[model samples]
Target chain A: AQSVTQPDIHITVSEGASLELRCNYSYGATPYLFWYVQSPGQGLQLLLKYFSGDTLVQGIKGFEAEFKRSQSSFNLRKPSVHWSDAAEYFCAVGKGNQGGKLIFGQGTELSVKP
Target chain B: DTAVSQTPKYLVTQMGNDKSIKCEQNLGHDTMYWYKQDSKKFLKIMFSYNNKELIINETVPNRFSPKSPDKAHLNLHINSLELGDSAVYFCASMGAGRGEQYFGPGTRLTVT
Candidate 1:
């Protein structure tokens, strides 16, 4: 079955440290990939997305994601994490012909340690 | 200026009661969508409207209905709300193409 998987349920990283959140999608062909972040008492914000072209994509909030077709993985990375970066991260997959429906993974919650 | 906005950010009501959540986008997007985030925080697409036309309807309860008054607005109505209906409902929109969707602050529905 087609699905999006987020392995880590919770991750803790010290402030100013590097961060990486893993996301994997199971599908036949490459689907439109996206990463969203949701903070407490806030809406889900689009972090970045990979449609085509270059595998490496930069997003807002100093975040970046790499789309690997062979691995079917689109992992989010940040070289230097900030305390304000603590939030719930989600990985979503969209198929254009599916009428804009998105399949999202069980989000991963990030905790920044002071 | 707000791109996408949802009214009644927090809703508390009893089961069997009916409620409606309104969403509007000032971005002039042609597509609008409704998504449900369950207790587990798993986001799932419930319904979508493209130019006032229903495009995607997932496996949702019949009690849940989505009405698109125009391209800029989409409202969700739930009849006979149940305890399981207690979840966050989010509204989102996209431009002409199916690219990144801008999301609105979710509505936290609490059914007692």
Candidate 2:
């Protein structure tokens, strides 16, 4: 079974600081990975996705993630995070050509302090 | 215009009552999906439809049924609801063979 693991349940960071959200996955083969953000009472918005080539993938809201096969990790990063970036982040894994059925992680809640 | 929308943003109903949540998308996507987020914020896929055809059906109980009248609309109906059924349900749509999904604002169901 394909599964996603987001180690952090809650993280607090000062405004304008660098942010890194860790994500790891376990799958039999190379999996399609994605990161999504959700605000209270709102639907999830895609942050970024990793399909193939170019291990470093850039996404909306100035976020980027690097897919590392050796580490089995795809961690989301942003050089500077604004207070508005505080939200729940989810890491998901899916099989290629499988109609995009995603297996999501428990999610990590980010808290930004001004 | 909302890319994906779900009706009845908030639903408060008594136990044993039946209810339905409707979803619509205007993105011209060929596939639609339903997901449930529990109290702990763990999301689980419930059902999926592609072009009004059932594609993926999770381990959800038979009390829950999904209907897709057309490619752009998918509705979820629950019968004899229980307190355990209370959760936030989301509707999402994506293009065929594409991983990008557009999600609806979700409906929070509360069972009393």
Candidate 3:
């Protein structure tokens, strides 16, 4: 079974501070990894994804994630956080083909303090 | 225009009643999916339709049915809804090349 784990339940960070949300997955193969952000009452928006090639991938809103196969992790990072980035972040794993169901982790809520 | 969309942004109904939620994708994607997000924001996949074919159906209850009329539309119908079904339902579509999925605004279902 392919599953994802996001350890932090909630994280508070200061604005303009670096942010990193850790994610780990267990799968049979080199799984397809993704990060998604969801605001209150809004649906999820893709932050980034890792399939093949480079270990690091950039996404919208100046977010990026690095895929570390040895650690079985794909952690999301942002050099400087903003208040707008205060939302719930989810880590997901796919079956690695073009179209497969994605299993999401328990989300981590992010709060930014000015 | 919205890439993916769902109808009845808000649905309030009594327990034991039946309801249907419709989803559409104009991005010419071949795959569509349905996910449920609980009050605590725990998300899980319910069903997936690829090219109008039922591809993945998780351990969803038989009362929850999904219909795909075409490659661009996927609808979910829940029968005899329970209070636990009160959550936000999202519709998503994934293109062939793009590993990312685009989600709709979501339909909030309230079963009272």
Candidate 4:
């Protein structure tokens, strides 16, 4: 069975501080990893994805993620956190060639303090 | 222009009532999906349709059925709605051979 785990349930960071959200996935074959962010009462917005290219991938809203196959982890990082960055972040593993089915993590809630 | 869109942004209904949530994608994607987000914000895939054909169906109850009249529209119909059905439902579309998915504004369904 495939699963995604986001270790941090809730994290608070000061504005302008560096942030990192941890994610780990379990899959049998080559993994397609993704990072998504959701604001309050809003649908998810894609942040970044790692299919089969570079280990580090950039995404919208000044977010980036690195896929570490050895560790089975895909963690999201931001150099400077903004108040607007306070939201829920999810890590997902895509089942390639399987109708695009995604197994999502439990999600980590980030809160920014000014 | 919205890439993917869902109707009835908010729905409040009594238990046992049947309701439908409609979804349409203008991106001309061949794959559409429905995801349920619980109050705790845990997201799960419920169903997926590829080119109007059922391709992925999770362990959802039989009361929930998905209908795709065309390649661009996928509608979810729930029968005998239970209080546990209260959650945010999201519609998403993905282009063929693309790993990225576009999501619509979710429909918050409140079953009383």
Candidate 1 lDDT over residue span B10-66, tens digit each: 999999999999999999899999999998898989999999999989989999999
Q: How well does each candidate superpose onto the true structure, as a TM-score?
A: 0.98, 0.98, 0.97, 0.98
Going through the candidates in order, their DockQ values are 0.83, 0.68, 0.73, 0.82
**Per-residue lDDT tens digits of candidate 4, residues B55-112?**
9999999999999999999999999999999999999999999887889999999999
Docking quality of model 2: it rates as medium
**Model 4 lDDT on a 0 to 1 scale:** 0.94
Write the residue-wise lDDT of candidate 2 on A1-114 in tens digits: 788999999999999999999999999889888999999779999999888999999999999999999999999999999999999999998863666688999999999999
Distance from true location, Cα of A8 in model 4, Å: 0.4
Candidate 3, residues A1-114, lDDT tens digits: the string is 678999999999999999999999999899889999999888899898888999999999999999999999999999999999999999999863725788899999999999
B56: Cα error in model 1, Å: 0.8
Clash pairs (backbone) in predicted model 4: none
Task: Please write out the lDDT profile of model 4 over residues A1-114, one tens digit for every residue.
Answer: 899999999999999999999999999987788999999988899999999878999999999998888999999999999999999999999965988998999999999999
Candidate 1 segments whose C-alpha is farther than 4 A from its true place: none
Compared with the true structure, what per-residue lDDT tens digits does model 3 show for residues B46-84?
998889988888899999999999999999999999999
What does the lDDT read for residue A75 in candidate 4?
92
Full candidate order by DockQ, most accurate first: 1, 4, 3, 2
- Docking class for model 1 is high
- What range of 10 consecutive residues in model 4 chain B has the weakest lDDT sum? B96-105
Residue B65, model 1, lDDT:
95
Winner on DockQ (2 vs 4): 4
Residues B10-94 of candidate 2 have per-residue lDDT tens digits of 9999999999999999999999999999999999899989899998899899999999999999999999999999999999998
